[model samples]
Every structure is written in structure tokens, then in C-alpha cells.
Target: MSAPLSRPSYAAVLRVPRARSTFAAALVGRLAYGVVSLSLLLATVRATGSYAVAGTVMALFGASTVLLLPLRASLVDRYGPRRALAPMAVLYAALLSVLAAVTWRPGTPAVVLGAVTALTGACAPPLGPTMRMVWGELVHDRRLLQRAYSLDGVAEELLYVSGPVFVGVLIRFASPSAGLLLSAALIAAGTCAFVASPVVGGLRGSSGRRQQGKSPARQRGLLQPVLVAAGAGLTLSAVDLLVTAFAERHGYGGDTVAWMLAALSAGSAVGGLLNGAIDWRTPARVRLPWQAAGLGLTVCAAGLAPGPWTLTAALACAGAFVAPALTTAYLIADETAAPGARTRAGAWINTAVNAGSSCGAVTAGLLLSHASLGVCFAAAGGAALVSAAGAVVGARGTAVAAVEAEPVPEAALEAESGRSGA
Candidate 1:
């Protein structure tokens, strides 16, 4: 038999010199998004002095963004990233500037704010999917690509953790407008730089298989991964609600809850890194259900913890399974998507996540009103268990293992291009 496969090192996988600038730029854009919903919510509340209006504004923006993402990704795939995103970047900035100004007007109509938010949401870039697609283009090795995604998962968690803090600081030291202004600036800069990067600048849509008369979007296996992603999102939101209720009930300070949440994020980042570093040799299809089940069960167990510290530990344990599950789902999406439709595929995964999170929050909230915290936790676990079932059933007959088993020629090309100094 051939030798056993060695674990892939993340350092070696990400050492693509030509890809660094693009990755960094996309990262900034992604991180900027972490602050947006919260900042806008705060801004809307400050302006209208009504939580209802603020909630409506934020909800519209989120829903619009999710609805428009597929279209945005399709545009990027049809045209090139540079051609598609550059104009969008400019328009997004202008709209944000307008929003900042409009929010300061006390008499601004809710409809007017809704329209602005809708337009702004439509303009939001598909940076997350774009970056991942670029990596698919830059790195051919399946193993290496997995590691890259792991890094991205870690970055995502970190950005979400710190982005709110950044926005809060800006709001504290400057004005409410400051957060929006900086977010606009960063998005603009990042989009411009990302589109100009060598790997993405002149890239065209993958029309090869489309010309051959097969559609990747219509593939049978795509729905499973999207469902899996949705399940992961649901679990996350459920846990968030659980922690919030736990803290409030126990008289724990907001800082304590934040630390507990931080521990979870930290565990996810660490798990993602470890998952990426080692070639577990398990197909994503096989890994996904187990990961989802693990997440659900962990969260359920956390509900049994007697104190904040115990809950924190349980959350961290649950978090460890989060990124690995997500990474697997993403990998599944990448593999199953039709050529030229990769961006839309990624967007679909995102859409599922958003929808699932909203559902999870609602479910947890309703449960919290009538049941003990443990019951809410149990429900969350049930949701995850359902997700795991979906994964198992959804992944039926997919050849993910065979695909990953194929030799990688892309990594060889990437290595020859240049290595990053990072």
C-alpha cells in the first residue's frame, strides 16, 4: 500500500505570495462586515429613539443582503470580480454616507430608511465567497484548500469577536457616524485591492461545463451542504440565546457573558486550526453529521452546568466543534457547485445560515418564555440533531471522498508562483 498521508501545515498552505494581497484585502472587507449590523442598529436607535424602528431597519438590511447575495455572486461570476465589484464598492460607500447623514435627521421616515437600507444591502460585496473562490483558483490541492478555509474560519471568529469592540470604540470616542464612515472606507479599500489582485483581476466565469450543457447549480447534492450550514447557524444562535438568558437570570454582568462567548469563539478558532493542520482523511460528508451532533449535544450538556464557569467550559467545548462542521459544509459546497456558479453556491450556504440563525433565535426565545433554560438547551440540541439527520440523508450518494482523493495539480502551480513572507 502507499504511504499514509501526512497532515498539511497551514503555514505552508497559505504561503502563496501572489495571493497575500488579495487575501488580506478580502479579510479586511469581511472583518468590516462584523461591525455593520450592530453599528447600524445603534445608529438607527440613536436617531429614531425607537427600538422598534431600529429593529425594523436592521432586519430589512439583513434580509435584503441575504436576498441579494445570490444576484451579486452571479454578477461576479458572469463578469469578472473587478468589473462587477468595483462599481458596487463605490455605490455602497455613497449609500453608507447618505445613511449616516439621513439617520441624524429626527424626522426621517421609516420608509425612507428602509429604502436606503435595501439599496445599501443590495450593494454589499460578495467578499466572503469571492475570497474562497479565489482560493479554489489559487490552491488546487484539496487538503491545502481545507487548511485555507480553516484559517478563514479563525479569522471570521476573531473579526466578529473584535469588530463590535471596534465599532463601540468609534461610537464612544467619535460619533455614531464614525462607525459607518470607517466601515464604508474599509469596504471600499478592501474591494478595490481585492479586485486588483493578480489572481482575481482578469478571471472570467467558468463557462466550460455550462457550454457542455450541464448545470452545477442544478446538481442533486448541493442542497445537503446548504442544509448542513443552516443547521450550524441554528445551533450558534441557540447557544447565544442560552448564554444571554443564563447571564440575565444569574445577575452576571455583560462582561461575564462576553467572556463566556469569547471562550466559545476561542475554542472554535483552535479547532479550525487543528482540523486544517491534520488530514483527518474523513470525507466532509462523513464528518458533517458527527460534528453537528457533537455541537448539539455539547450545548445541551452546557445547560446542565451549575454555574457560569461550568457553562463557559461547556460552551467552549461546544464551540470546538463549530468551525470544523462549518468548514466541512463549505468544502461540500465548493465541491458540488457548478462551474461559474461557485459564488452563488456559497451565497446559498450563507443564506441558509442566516435563515437558520433567525429560526434558532426565535425558537430559543419562545422556549425561554415558557420553559427552563435546560429545556431551551435541549431544544437547541434537538435542532442540531435534526441537522445531523439532514446531513446524513442529504449526503446520500455524493462522491465527496473520491473527489478529495484525486491528486491536486493546483497546489503545484501555486507553489511555483511565489511564496508569502508571512
Candidate 2:
């Protein structure tokens, strides 16, 4: 007989039948998102010769994407991913190709760039939210879901970091437009593989639609997690700008800024994995606020660091809370969603993060001019603390208590999960 498995590990997540292939395909496509934003910005600047134009185009793209997220996710819920996600990916890729060709040479018309970019953002497939929903479908056990989210979040963090580096390398030998073209290709291929996965094939049928029609599927508990998620995004972004200013004030080089950011990412990755490894009896709802508050406290302390090294250490410590917090939010999202509505639930969390990031960048900038660096950091932390407080207050007033995301019972698991086994 084969030796019995002893401990739960991230490896167990991959062992779920069809989950490995589905998740791998999703990641391949998601890497394109990491590459596209920077590549587009650089390509636009090169062609238009104006940072203002490039920045505006990027902002429009972000806003359009965030605004339409829930609607797109709703389409996926109403239709299966194969029906909904495929056309979206195809159109998005085609528009990206148009973007690449237009910006390949200098002097592309600004009007043309803006038009294509807005359309591209609108068509961008809701791959990340879809993937998280897939994880929910694949892993019925609560522990496995935690590991899956943690793993997914950590991998995503790395993808964004590496995406920029990849663009930098590509620009050295080729034009930034080449990176956009590559992103187009990556998304097309990855999305095709993802939709075609056997597990995804199980997500079809009208059961989801019927389930969503029921009153129990209302998803009343979403606000607390969403609020916390927004807070996390806001303060985390402020840390980026804060670190840049912190590095400059200390006479540190640009490399120090990079190192500090990288440290934050590393800490998040480690923390996420560690968080998943534990078997917690506590509900995600209970843990989430404390996680946000812990992050708030650490960021506030980061402001008090006396030296560059200490500040980096402080940021790293704060980042340790990052992935775990986001992971918990997604868990709550999955729990709160109805059978067919997981995509919409996850998309709301994504939207919250982006909205918070937009405000955070501007808020940090404004605070920098009027306040000391320490004050700026404190303000960032305070945002998170307020979010935590709001969650607590909202819970008290609401008729519905935010329920814990408990493991699905075996009978229900078999009915709900996709091509199960790990």
C-alpha cells in the first residue's frame, strides 16, 4: 500500500484533480495583466511623447476596468465561463494587438490610443475573480480553500513584481510595444486553456441560475470584508509612496526603494503560506478585522523607524499581514456567494481593492505635502483602523451576523465541488 499522507501542505492544493491544470492556465494568462499596464504606459509615452497623455490613458483604462468588473462577473455567473469568458478574452486580446500596432512606431494619435484602451479595458476578462471562484468550486474543504487563496494571492503578488521586471528587460532589446503584443498572446493562450479545463466544464448547467434566484443567496455579509479589503489596499499603496520618500529622505539610492518593496512582497508571501498551514477554528469574519488592525498598527510603527534599514524591516513586518488579510476577504466572498454568483462576489472584492488604491495614491500624495512623513504613515494606518472599526460597528447594527466560512459537509461537497479529489 502507498504511504499515508501526514500533513496538509500547499502541495495538497495542486493535487486536486484538474485544479493543477486550471490554475496553471489562469496564472499564465494573469501574467499578461502584470505585463500589460506597464508596457502600455511605456509604449504610450514613447509614441505620444507626453507623460500626461500616458497617465490619463492609464487612468481611464483602470477606471473602466474597475467600474465594469461586477457586471462582467455577472455575465459569467449568468453564463458559464466558456460562454462568457472566451469572447471577452478574444476581444481584449484583439484590442491589445491594435494597441501594440498603433504604438509600435512613434507619433500615434492620442485619440486613437484612448479609444482602443477604453475598449480593451472593457473587454478585459475577469480572470482573477474567475480563478478564485474556481478554487471555491474545486476545494470544498475549508483548510484547502485557505491554502488555495494564500497560494493564489502570493503568486499574484509575485506576478505583478515580475511583470515590471520583464517589461524592463524587454525594453532593453525591443520596443515596449513588443511587450503589449506578448501580453495579448499570453492572455489569449492562457484563457483558452483555462476555459477548456475539465474542471471548468463542470461549472455549466442552469443549477447556478436557479440557486441564485433564491433569497438565501442575497450575500448580505459582503460589506465588512470589502471595507477591510479597501483599507488594506489603501494603506499598502501609501506604503509604496511612503517608502520612496523615506528612502530619498535618508539619502538612500533607488535600489533601496526596490529592496524595501521587494521585502514587503517577500514577507507577504511567507505570511500567506504560514497562514494557510495553520488549522484555525476561528471564522474568517472574526480573524479579518484583527488582521486589518494589526496591519494598521505595524504601518503606524513603520513611520517611527529611525533608519532606512529599520524602516525596511518595519514594512516587511507590515507586509506579513497583507496576503493573509486578502486571503480571508476572498474566503468570505466565496462563502457569501450563491452557487452561480461566486464570480460577482469575488469581483466586488477586486473592485474595492482598485478603488482604494486609486484613492490611496492621491491621498498619500496630498498628505506628503502638508504633513511630516511620520504623519503620512499614521494617516495611512488610520484608514485601516477606521475600516476595522466600521466592520465592527456594522456587524453590531445589522440583523445578519457575518458567518464563518465553514467547511462544506461531505454530501454537499460532492454536489457543489467540481471534479473533486486532492
By lDDT, the best candidate is 2
RMSD of each: 8.7, 7.0
lDDT of 1: 0.81
Per-residue error for 148 in candidate 1, Å, reads 0.5
Provide the lowest-lDDT 10-residue window in model 1. Answer: 208-217
- Model 1 TM: 0.90
lDDT of 1 by residue, 1-422 (tens): 11114445677655665666778889888776887877788888878889999888888898888878989988887787888889988998889889888886577888899899989998998899888778778777788889888888788788888888899788878767667878789889888888888788868864443532133334546777787778888888988888988999999989888989988998899888888887777788788899989988998898899899999999899989888988887888888776687777777788888889988888888888899998888888778888889888777644554355456777676777775232
lDDT (tens digit, per residue) of candidate 2 on 1-422 = 11114355788888877878899999999999999999999999999999999999999899888989999998888888998899999999999999999999998788889988998999999999999988888877778789889999999999999999999999999999999998999999999999999787667734344566234324447777889889998998888999999888889999999999998999899889899988989988788888889889999999999988898899889999989989999998888777778888899999998899889999999999999999999999998899888767654533243233344578777667763564
Q: lDDT of all predictions, in order shown?
A: 0.81, 0.87
Off by over 4 Å in 1: 1-7, 206-218, 397-422
